[model samples]
Target: MKQPLKVAIVHDYLNQMGGAERVVGVLHRMFPEAPIYTTIADRRKLLPELQGADIRTTWMQSIPGILRRFKHFFWLYPFGVRSMDLRGYDLVISSSSAYAKGITVKGDTRHICYCHTPMRFAWDFATYMEGNEASPVLKAAARLLIKPLRWWDRATSARVHQLVANSTIVQERIQQHYGRSAPVIYPPVNVSRFEVSKEPPGDYLLVVSRLVSYKRIDLAVEACTRMGKRLIVIGDGPDRDRLKRLAGPTVQFLGRLPDGEVVRYMQHCEAFLFPGLEDFGITPLEINACGRPVVAYRGGGALDTVIPQVNGLFFSEQTVESLEHALRSLTHYAWDSAQIRKHAEQFSEEVFIRNLASLIEGQLSSRNPAARPAVPALAHKKKGAVL
Candidate 1:
């Protein structure tokens, strides 16, 4: 019998849990034997599913205080990624938003990069620095590094055998920045975790996101305050204090809550508010799974998931006035809970796995006609066969 193909997964870092880390978790489940390689992994911040996985970190992990202040050592990540030795793996899949895709792989190994977006700091310096609270000296240093980082980021795109984008906007970015076209694969959402609420929707609006400046959470707070609409803000970040000062008495900050409690909020909220322009926003779909409509900014990933008057409404501008107008407009529409939930089911984790598995298998076959499958054929399997 032919030996099974050796597979490996690479990510920029595993220090924080977010949509990117969630994608890595799904990738780990798809290829259970594949060891995950990263520059660093913060055990305390790793997701429950990733705690038991075979995670291998680079020398950067040994650096003092790297976990708490990884961004301060941004210039060193490319070197850290290059230090990974992926020689024996027949296939390597990189889940990257930054330096992971720059990993040096053997010529024979097929490297597929599931790019969340090209490194935001490199390609969109101003936007990346907008809401950040770095010191003036650090900010100036980062600005100087941006040009060289952009060069490195562009050069690394050619290293991957195949590129997969998480959204259409990201796909466009790949073409524009790297001169490479990538197929769009929408990120997965665990729709099964949420259920349509039997109870009537609550009066307050909801915002579940990291309280970051670029996220534009301020729009939600300011708009709700001006309109005197009750708003519940979940998740905490560096921008928390500024947002709290901007918020009115009607706005409440819950900070971070357990996933179960978040689901309860989603199920009960009159409408979920998404004020940021994300590459792909998964939270809106989570709320949609709970049969709640979303009021979101019109651009970015929102274009791909939210169908106006179907599952969510969109504000054309990213300002408080525009979002407030959309919120007011939401009251006039007749939303069908069942229809909203059905729309969200399309982006479920199962669909993502099947699509990604098929892509991997196809790439492996094309590379070596007689080679064994790199990923199991989850698309053709019966229910509960490989999940």
Candidate 2:
């Protein structure tokens, strides 16, 4: 019998229950015995399914208030991630939006990175700094380090044996930023959990997201308020209070709720409002799975998932006026709920797992002399040293 490859899963952090965490959860389920490596984990915020996994944290885990303040210690990440000893694992799979992909492995070991995007702050510093709440002095300090961080990001990215991007835009980003090619693999949506509501949809539009500056939830609040449309916002983040202040009486903030409650909200909402550029917006796909249409920003990952006049309508610009235009247009069109749900079925969790498994197996098979057909050493050398 062939021995199973020992696998190790690495993620940037485990402090939030978001799309990235859901990817980690699926990866863990696929490799049940594989250990998970992260910078730090907050059990209170992590999914219950992930609590039983063998999660190992690095030295940064001991830093003061690191769980709640990991972003504050960005300078330490390169050192902290490299400190991990992954020499024993035959296959290392990193689910990264940041430093997890930087983990080093022995030449004999294979490393596959499911990249969300090259570190957003390093590649898009100007945009990331916008609407940031950091002190001016701290922001200035960050500005000084951008050069070093960019250099480190590019250098570390080359360490991976293979790269799998979460969307086509991310694939292009990997090529542009790292000078490497990657296959596009969309993020999984748990279509089974969300059911289409039997009743007529509610009068209110909905926005569900981490209330971060870059997410641009403020646009939704502004558009809905200005149009005098009833809107419901469900999420919690640093931007929550500010968003609440900007919201009009027609808008309601529900904060964070249980997944079941969120699903019900998705089912009943008139249309899901997605007014931000995303790497691959899974929420819009999830809303579609619940038989609802989405009003999304036109750029980035939304371009891949939200088919215009099908599952969702796209706003060409990110401004309040542009979103307001889309919302008004949304009212004029009739959406086919069954067809929207069918489009979402293409990106189910099972499809994600199957594609990822096939990709990883292909990497392993290409490495095994007994499994792969023989090629001349010169030919192999010409193909370039396999990572």
The candidate that wins on lDDT is 1
Question: What is candidate 2's lDDT per residue for 242-350, written digit by digit as tens?
Answer: 9989999999999889888999999999999988888898889899999999999888999899898899898888899999888888878788889999999899887
The ten-residue window of minimal lDDT in model 2 covers 378-387
Model 1 Cα lDDT, one tens digit per residue, 1-387: 556778899999999999999999999988888999999999999999899999999999999988977887889999999999999888899999989999988857889999999998898877767655579998997888999999999999998899999999999999999999999888989899889989999999999988878899999999999999999999998899999999999999999999889899999999999989999999999999999999999999999999999999999998988988898899799999999999999999988887787788778777665665434344356654445
Instruction: For model 1, give the 10-residue run with minimal summed lDDT.
Output: 371-380
Q: On a 0 to 100 scale, what is the lDDT of residue 360 in model 2?
A: 76
TM-score, model 2 to reference: 0.91
Q: Estimate each model's TM-score.
A: 0.96, 0.91
Error of 2 at 204 (Å): 1.1
> Per-model C-alpha lDDT, please?
0.90, 0.86
Error of 1 at 87 (Å): 1.1
Task: Count clashing residue pairs per candidate.
Answer: 1, 0
